[model samples]
Target: MAADSTRPVRIAGASGSVSDRRHAVSMFAANCGDDKVDVIVGDWMSEANMTARGVMKIEASSNISTSKSGDTFAFGDAGAAYEPTFIEAIEPALSDIEKHGIKVAVNAGASDTEKLAKVMTDLIKSKSLSLKVAWVSGDEVFPAVQKAHAEKRSKFENVSTGAVLDNWEFTPIYAQAYLGGLGIAAAFAKGADIVVCGRVSDASPVIGAAVWWHGWSRDQIAELANAFVAGHLIECSNYVCGGNFTGFKSLESKGWHDIGYPIAEISRAGQVVITKSKSGGGEVSTQTCSSQLLYEIQGPWYFNSDVTAVLDGLWFEQLGTDRVALRGVRGELPPPTTKVGLTARGGYQAEVHWFLTGLDIQDKARMLEAQIRHALRDWSDKFTKFEFTLNGTAGENASNQNAATVDFRVFVQAREEKDIAAARFLRPNIDGMMQGYPGSTIHLDVRQGFPKPIYEYYVTLLPQADVQHKVHLWDGQEIEISPPPQTKTYPAQQPSEPEATGVASTDFGQTVKGPLGWIVHARSGDKGSNANVGFWVRHRDEWEWLRSLLSVKTIQRLLEDEYRGKKIDRFELPNMYAVHFLLHDHLDRGVSCSSSYDFLGKNVAEYLRSKHVDLPLKFLNRGKL
Candidate 1:
């Protein structure tokens, strides 16, 4: 391989390994293979990643030993426990780069720029590396800009000022504000060897580099958009190069112990070529690259670098190992309005579900609503906000063979636990026949599970003045940032299991644990558990064979034994071999209700695993079961 200095240079992007940081840095070092690149990007954090950055900071901060699933109290102001292990692997490469005068830039933290900055400032100052400071967090800002657009009376008003003055009261769980790449590009242009920043929109890193290197302008929106897309593909670090491709087969055969990080070889014109380090995990297929092009994108008008992209003529094909060619992506002039970021105060919320059954399903649904309001009467004074929603309406509509069995959801925000707890006690209301309703049904389950904080999402645009970049440096200089003191909290104890109230039965003896597995199919007239189970299965012949064995009798027997007395109506689709069962009312002595059609239905495959049956069960709606 030959090295070229005249053309826009390429960089290696890698990070995000469960092991040590050295693994990620080393993976990229080996792939660069004598070629000197411009930058290095490390990615951590998911799209809605809620992991507290405070936990990944300062060396003194201790990680809470308790698991996050059961505890929600991990919010400490102290920086998080992040060991920059990847930076270790990059040591040799950094040393080599210093020899050749090539620069490097790595993220301070993947999620929170504010937090990453605190930690990164410490590292650069302590290590004495000639690393420049740059902060990138446009993805976090975009949604705020979107909300401002919707809330403010006019776009011309200083919407960002409104949001900031209001203390950014409308923040989402995850914010990916599309940022212009100019600052990042300027950092590179200024001869920074290593730049540290936070949450730089994936595309911005590359777009910034492109503009910085080529001196492109906002008027070159399409060109900028193309660069943004190319950058975006490589931004996820490995997805575009096949890290998460569902179509990936023969992964072991691909010899990907050290998976490659993607690199986009872009031109001054709006053309791009996708490639990865020679030694990377996964493939660089056109399919894989295209998947990244549209990831989580709501529409074609993807924003970045102050431009909107019009991706009409995207085309790509494999180009040997670890390489895929891309062309035909077009972009148009962007809208005049700029996007902004905001975080607002949020209200408490509760989600409640109730099962409704019997003929005249629509009328039954109406009656169910009335009963819900009546049940809430005692606690009505405590709730400041309340909303009754019919979740999974499409699934409910499809499940009504004779009559609809509905799950109605009610959400409320209240001052005290009992105000919310009122709904939990009301779970037993529909176990049997009601005063005005015919036939009996179980109330099934209530979302009595503890209520967690929920936030509303809003997006708006702020005038350019409202948003500005601030960079702080630390040369072992102590900054006065008082991270919340780290405190350890014990996990809550689990409740003892309730003693069995009745004898258990194992009557429907035989078990065929093929695709259906050892699923406890619910009975008919059950509006909750008897819902559809959906999964993807290739190879039609195998599916048809599985379909042939799942007899109505087999399904009926499963229901009979599971529910003891209720009957079920089985519906099958051999093409997909997906099954939907409409279940009968419960037989739990009118005390416990079985919701056969609730939520997304049961984990039939997982249940079979619990029974020590190893066969896989494919459902129609739920993901792989």
Candidate 2:
């Protein structure tokens, strides 16, 4: 088929993560409204997910003991090292996909693209469908990384901490570099009906589908940028359709049990209108779109393996019910290097929780902590880290027992399993329970008291030229994809001051103090050891106040419990009426090994929203958020 530049390409997002809804593909394929879906893209790779999958592959490899070669993994075996959830999600939708001739693309291959492709092919053959399956490779670079480290070719410094691999205590067992979408585009062009990929960027599937549908060249930066933004928006499926929106309370009446996935009708000129199936639940309003836009992002420059999307001027306009138009997205060439995640064995960790009920909550917690510390004093030096955390406060004037109780958690991590074994770690906490404060009792669940393995995820960048990006067609033909001819080098750190949207000074007469959430909404998530929280206002007039009030210092003060002394970066997205902050090294290590209560940082925004702050009476008079 020749390219149709005039017709818009409709891409439906089926899955966001490895554990996303299993029925998403079937729902999108059968119920995507009047405009049929041309391509269905699922994003299954993340920093933590990659780390877990890498560990699985390294453990499964027999060559790990002999050649010291990280390359010889057991990826050829069926059901080895790939996300099985993807297979489950796609099998039920195959009939609809075959009926509608809908194309499928997903980064579900994890550490093994070839095996995933084989599984898909076998499934299609079993169903007697004519669909062709292709897989993109070159993401697994463990052997190459080890060689580079030994030869001192690259420092592989931690992108977050700037510490070189030389200082790393754990051995590098696995590594996978993020690949671009050009390989996917090639597979699609070569007549592939389904594309399986390893660690391509999350948005690469959508980008590749758009590039193939519209016949876009590499020089088409503006259009590619729009596709990149569209991919980012819908890549998380229901996320843009109100899954994690701050205004979720407003959607309760409509129901959230079966929230709809998103579909992007991207035009050849790079315009996009996001919508969802009429039969599914959830709203696709501007607020929902804005929430997804701010998620897991770093400042105004959103980098992907494909292209750099400049989101400062981006705006979302609600076209109607379940329809939001995204515009003003500009593009720049991709960065010279792409992110590579290296996984290693960090150690073992365990935690035990004790409930302190009724009077003298603080005193009870202090007493319990002192007792546990004294009990573990002899073996404390064997542990690498130890911390005591008090969660919640006892209510005043009494309520029920559960309502009047607080929890004290004792967490510890060690380099060796025996250091945190039952005798050394769990027993001390249990021994102190009888000698503890009044009404002291541990949680019924004892599973967490046992030490579990921890995998530390280290992120660094690798030059695009070093990756051997390739696509394998259904017929066994392999196509090599070259790096983008035009590329730009971004600064190691974001600019101290992003170009502000320059709002005119205005002052309302009186001010009232209340929770910031009274007039503002927020969304937040983790990126490695860092967390990004973006705050936005529902009303346009509140933009100036929001941007003015939320400085790095103010955020530190608001989130003082966890982010007080942390280095923070602030940026503005004036068009969205949002101010974003990136708190550095907030999550101890990444998700796999973090000991923070809010391990994924999903509650960072909610925590900030709960804090009281002075708000303009004019905005509060209009309505509370």
Candidate 3:
């Protein structure tokens, strides 16, 4: 290997969330890889995380930690700073982070980069660490939003659906625009040891680190796209290293609990090598990389605030142990518009749960529902929603009493606080415990039946010219930025699935019906109101079988019970040998406001695995039955 003027920049993602910082540090401590990481990036701010932070900022100074006993929340200055969890998590490893001149880049600043900078600088000073901390701001566009609404009475439209703001039932309390890597790169160029920002795109830290190392410009479209692809690959940290992998069977259970985060070795010429720490326990295979490549992505053009990356013609190869090289990504000029995430109070929701054990569980649920409706008839109209779901069930069998149990979930959403009170939703169930279900029982968590504030999200787009991506240098110098010059034209194309490769007679064999997971692996996540699920097989020969079996109708049939009220779109990634489906509005109103059991849609794939599917005996057993 030849070394250019700029060495291969090694950028490693440490934590996907500030909350992950503590465990991430533990993972890092466990992996004592000799190679020094040039830059470490941490993404603590996510769209859902931002929404929760906004609501907490409105409700209280801090958020309550679920890891501890009831009701105690983490508090700081009311609106002055972000959650200090990241700061605290990194304190124990301050020495390690500054070792070998390893600089840190993170978007854990949440809503206030200024305050985060101050808090971090104070901590650094108190620790007497020789590290300079700089920050980037201007992701906040709430003032602009207010101005646009007040002055023009303009209705901000959804970027995906073009739905106007007036259609929303709630107004936003916080709005943040997506930022690019220029500010981060600028800060790093200015001799800063740590670069912090608020609401920067998740991959921006990696992009910035690469840009600073390579001295690349915004116009370096292809090069920046390479860095962008590398950043996107490792942005979720452990995802590239067998974490939540579809091909988990390929990797044994060893060291899985202590999965290592990913490290990207990128070249100035746009080559990428993804690997993990030698000491950490996890496999970095082509399958893992493929799985992550399609995670939460929609369509072909991989859009980031920095560049529009072309996923076509990309290649993945395993160079050596725990290393995979990704190359051949093309790119174009950045999009004219950037996404802005806004959050509002959606009102309140209350929930309660009951266990209907033994025989006639379904009948018991029906009776309980009928009685509740009759009792709350006069006041039932006040609620925005009233829902009941049979959580889990007992199969037909002769077994222990526990095997004969099923849970009934009673959920309600109301506009007025009084409409969803305990008296209205929770107590009404208590009245039925004796007279309704024969074997009714209560859960240990008595506090579940209560009202809680719900937050809603409204995502839209703003022209790049309207927002400023600026850097705040350590020495108090500010640099304003403009988008790169437009240089290419992207023709709109309709999305269509690959032509099905009809199965052959030789491929036919005895058929068996069982869980999909018996032969394939799956991963599910959320993209706002949409639920994204990707399924793949470990063997290349299984690709056709998997792809052919997972048509739009098949996926709909599998997820029909969970469908929220929209059509499902299926797309095939022949390169990755995977099938991806996006179920619109399946998450109800998205993370914060969703009344769905799986708001994040993280469990959608696992649920699909439970659905029985026909499997060719040759594919399942590689044998003639």
Candidate 4:
């Protein structure tokens, strides 16, 4: 029998990333109430994760070349090709899943879907559970990308830098297209109990599960858009339930030991109410939802493989404790292209750190840099890039020794391992300690100085028609999924800066200069080499003031010197009382190869919040943040 479409579909998010708590599946399965969970979705892949898996696959193949049998390397070997952690996460929950008749969807098949699917099927059999498993594939498109580039059909341009791949110096190894949810929906429609995927979009599983439960057709654009937003909100599991919320102080009393995962009660009318299990920790309020909504998004228009969500007018209401109703989301046809990530072997990198203590920290750093430079001058040209940075400043008149000490770092990258070897990189620094400035000492651990392999990540768009989306059922039946009939082409350039509105006047009476965090909350994340930071105020009165204060020029001025020259795009979300900035080429060559201290860009929001800005005395009178 089909599910009743009138009732809302309950979707639970179990895992946010590869490292998220492993027991989330069991927790969600065991905590169901009168309104049970219909489906569980887990997002377990990222750009860095793909690169690491690709490298592992390549290394495993290399090792197989010298084997006795002389057989080709097999991707079926789950250890090197897929995320084995998913098995652990779901193993204990099998009984609950079977008892409750719940469906499971996950993108844990990092590089190999069929293998993981087989493993899951065998596990189900071992438990004597009558569950059917399926897998989705064809996300890998390295050969197709190369062919397209060679035929001049596409340039495979870097989305962040606008650089053509023709001039790329690294050797390409892996490419995967972001697929839509229709494939997962197809598997579920065929009675699949568990669906595994490789490179589907992070939110695709939610959209797929919703589509399956509601029996939605391809033309249901508005409902699909709502599902897309719901997916994004809970895709990070605990994120929407105070995991990364700025109001974490409030959750400390509730206990952070078992922070809850998020659930979306999505209705056929496109309405969504976000909540969590009764037994879990953490609170769900409008502010927490706002934080998750503002995270990792580039602009007012949030693009997904299934639908393009117009988030400009999106708003939320707190109905009760741990329940927020999302509203006002609009929809459009998905963009003509879907994002694709390509990984390449960039080379090797190494770093070493030294402690600078007490007075003359600046002079001590300068002396150490000069000494290292002079020592390595003869071989400096061998390195592709070299950098010296003095991280943080010692506190003035410090009471503790740690407070009076700062770190000096030296980082280098090169084409060959020998160029960044410890003998060449760390020996000079060690020898200079005797003649170095007073109180100068290298870090106790020397492992960081050793060269390690790194992979460069590039993101671009591929036409939907180019992707070979398909689903493999447990019974060996294969289903091919076609591209959507409707898609709109959006301008490649960022949208024009939005004009400030709703402000009665620039003047807010009296003012006090203080950190922006005093009245604003923020969240930031990375997309390839680009980073997005979004700021939102709690009260409606602060909306106009925030819009007037955070212009593009002001943001550029506040950014670090290295990021000042990079291009930036700013957009507004009026309903959320928020402004967002997208910093391009901000993380070097993305997380796998970036040398930045904040490589993942998670701390960019906190850094921005720390910047001093004039605040309205009236708003400050309400209370300190």
Candidate 5:
């Protein structure tokens, strides 16, 4: 395909290190010389940087090296992972902007906030930079904000900033900090035209910018939400524009090096055009963009800003080359809830490794287990539970084919601070062996470990009244909140079931719930995929009430009736309102290891209508809308 000329160029500049931030900004500015660019985005922080930051700061003095990866575990004293410093990456990006006449936004607080803000403030003092810079604080910013809020409990609003941090009380894996476009919006209000953020969910930038540009109102949340969806689609930058194109293999292409950042041209009408750096690589076709949108879309309740984005009304269409438009986007009023990120002391963990050889893989596994069991028996009272995974030459694909060799890995844990004491005491598991097959191939080692704290976050809604929006402006900065969409609905009718035990019996069909209503799964598939849709029942209560009627006697009655001399099997689809009972061996375990679907079976439509033919008047009504 070709690129669109009318769209403003969206640029993505890369900075390999924090020191390169200025260079990255300069590079972006040089590329946009004398031309108008709508938005400038940068990706500075990564996962490895967060872990290292927490560990080295324990004593208030960091002995930690300034690198992403910490010490190694294999070579005696390997360091832990390092987190990116906020100031190191963002300050330069800001500096580059001052050097060049460019307005941009960045992910600053994603790594470290106070440090990053200090970097920005320092740059302002040194260069006399009067740039409009948006601050993207890391997840850590929330705790500090919350602490201040709690201290000013009675005078909450006095201490509370208009832009509230989410999931602060509950610690989230990785950075749980959420930026709902407020910081970027604040920066836009300041007229910097450039926003720098850290750890803001990928889509917040676009959503914030769109809301700022459109002059939307708070009541227009659905439009903001629709913009949020567009942001979600492109925030990963190239991910939507063919970077990880599942349909195509070769990602390498000319001009891919100058991959422009993604741009969402959102209109007040909820019209969105997802395009990328005119200089970027790959195609922005519907297939490419839509696939990214579908990535990890867990279910109907797509949670964000503590609000559930009902995805049913959302639709996508490719309007032109490199332009995919979104429509039918709508959102419900946000739940009056605020989920806080909380951090707490967790459990202690440790592990050991051993290599076994000379055939009898199962025997080797048993022998290793015996050794660990005996060692644990000696100090069994000191620990909670032990877990083992003996991997080696036992299965069809063995690591060592020459002879049956097994690599035994063992893990032990407890809630105590020094829980590995029981494990350390059992160190002799490596040397002590009761079996005679221990030959030259035997090797043992007692692994050492340190107590590392694991952090997690949870989401709980607070009353909408508890959370307030605060808009900070620099000079003439304005806040625009989009209005919700106007909604319309239509009634739908179910298809008539084909007659069973008749010539017109060859047929099949699938059931989907009407718009907005959730389909329920009475039972789940064993393998954790697909649900067995036995029959479609209307009322939500009918599904609940049917389970109560399924007694052991009902099975006996069915056996004595139609299924008397025939064989029958049952399966359930865990995800939807469906179940399937195979009449005879009609469908083999062909499709999904479990027979959730039947391609070779007799007409299931006929069977469902026949089975429930004698349904009570109430039962028939229950299946209807």
Candidate 6:
């Protein structure tokens, strides 16, 4: 890549800690560098998270009327406005933000972003800081989603099932389209120090910073793609910093409790090096960086609101200590359509736990199920879900009592919260206590839990032309961005067979039937209903063996019970010596709808790691290689 006429830019990642706000803020403050970081960005918005925010607003609204009489959890709108995660997380870092001249960006402003911006401004004013605050708007596409069918512009069809939205089981609240960095770029160009967006793509902040700092245009697809990858790499903060990493054994021994957020040094010439703070814990290398790069990606063509990047040729290089440089990122014109995360009030859900101890656990579970079925025989049809899961198995001759106990859980999901909460619904098993099998016991919350509302996410595409992308500057100037006209789509690609390895030329190391974790590091997560599990090694020697050992057929066999002949796509990243598998509908359904034990599919990799595989003795001896 030829050098552009602009200097490089640096940005820090500070979120994916929406719920861990205090730690996020503290880490952000600790990561500030007066002469290093140029922009700090984070994203806390997601389909499920936004829906949860709406529920909080409704609950807070209900608490309002009672607050006038006394102090209530419902402080009303004030409570709703109270310390939003996006704004609140930055409060402790305000001083460092100004001192270091670091511009901050975040999408923590879920549904009530206007209020979030206002609260943040007031907080800034109280501190007597002259920070310019800007907020991106026009993400609200509810009106567009409602008329999508009538206008013939978009369809909310289930990606896996081909089911249309008209026959959806629940009522939708609203739809928010994923915006790109153009809005954030506009704000930065207009001199806004802080940018808050509602549903901007997670990597948009980094892209926006690069655009502003490097003075790049929309046509700089390669540069944009590089920055986009940089943003994606660090968007989840500690993820690339070894949180939930398969090689976390090293970090744990190093006392990585105060694991620092990462900082990316990006260049105008398309070079990016990801590094952690001087005071942080955790290490950054090619392995960790590659794990996150393929975190939620679908395939060769990765789509963002701004650009469609090609990751098939991507590569990474470790540059001394805790730094890794991403290289060979390429991008094509973005699709004409943008993805919208639509969520609706699904209904309500509740659960009860029953502990069955000792032997004959299966019989006890059967006995319990029969009694419950008999009690709810007439009302069984009322619930959307009525399930009994055996969460544990009693160990043979265990040293501890808990090890001999098996967990029997009963869960119910219904349209009405109170219906599941009915005393008759919860007390039946308790009513038959004496008739219960020997060693039967109940946990503290044997009674059904309080009703919790549910939200089902429906992801669909909307024509970008229909969305009005606007950026509001602190000075009341709103900039409208025209959507790029180019568009395309990528159908699922089939997995290719691995290249045959020579068993004759090479010393095929002695094999031992042990856990796969003994040789390889893995990371897995959900992409809608699909589960993407990626495994990589720290050494070049283990690449071929790792890749050849975990082909699609082997993966299917490893996860036989769960996969059950599902469509799975395999892709390899030679740059990172990694192989990834995309198992379709393997999660049963998505987070809200999935009946699987691992809802988000985060444990798929760990479960596979525990599976007995023919581990290469040589690789095991070189441990952490």
Strongest candidate by lDDT: 4
**Candidate 3 lDDT, 419-458, residue by residue in tens:** 8677877787677667766766766485767777666788
**Tens-digit lDDT track of model 5 for 1-625:** 1112244324343332232323434445555544334555555433223333333333134453422212311111123222233334445555555555555555544334435444565567687777644444334443444554567542221011121234233232222344456556556655654555545555666666665566566567677677777766765565566653433333455344544445666776556777655554676766565445544242343445522455544556678877777665566555433333322223344556566655566676776677667766755566554666665454455556545556676655455545465335444554465442455233444433333333222222222233333333434344442212332221111111221111222121233323111221111111011112233233334434333333223433443432333333333211222223333322322121111223322223223332321233443433432
lDDT of 2 by residue, 36-140 (tens): 788999987666567666777777684332122122222222325787778888899998888877888998898877988998999999999989999999998
Which of the predicted structures, 3 or 5, would earn the higher TM-score when compared with the native? 3
Q: Runs in model 4 with CA error above 4 Å?
A: 33-35, 62-79, 498-502, 560-562
Residue 225 in model 6: lDDT = 86
- Candidate 1, position 453, lDDT: 35
User: Clash number for model 3?
Assistant: 0
Q: Please provide TM-scores, in order, for all candidate models, with all chains considered together.
A: 0.52, 0.94, 0.90, 0.95, 0.56, 0.91
Residue 570 shift from truth in candidate 4, angstroms? 1.4
lDDT of 1 by residue, 1-625 (tens): 1223357557555653223234545545444446445556655432112223322221133433322222222222323432234345455555445445544445434345545555554556676655544444333443444555468634422221223334443343333333455656656655555555554445556776677666776677667877877776786676666664444454567755645567777666756777877654677766566545544232334554355665434556567766776666666654443443222223344555655554465676577667766766676677656655544332445545334555555556654445555344244243323653454353345434344332322334443333444333333222121111221221111111111122233132334344342332211111112222222234443344334434445444444445444443333323322333333332211101112222222233223223332233333323332
Lowest-sum lDDT 10-residue window in model 6: 66-75
Q: What TM-score would candidate 5 get against the native?
A: 0.56
Give all candidates' CA lDDT scores: 0.46, 0.83, 0.74, 0.85, 0.44, 0.74
> CA RMSD for every model?
17.1, 3.5, 3.9, 3.2, 14.2, 4.0
Residue pairs clashing, model 2: none
- The residue-by-residue lDDT of candidate 6 on 184-295, one tens digit each, is 8888878788888888888899988888888888888888888888988999888888777877778876557867678888898768999987666888878788778767
- Residue 414, candidate 1: how far off, in angstroms? 5.8
Sort every candidate by lDDT, greatest first.
Answer: 4, 2, 6, 3, 1, 5
Q: Model 6's lDDT to the true fold?
A: 0.74
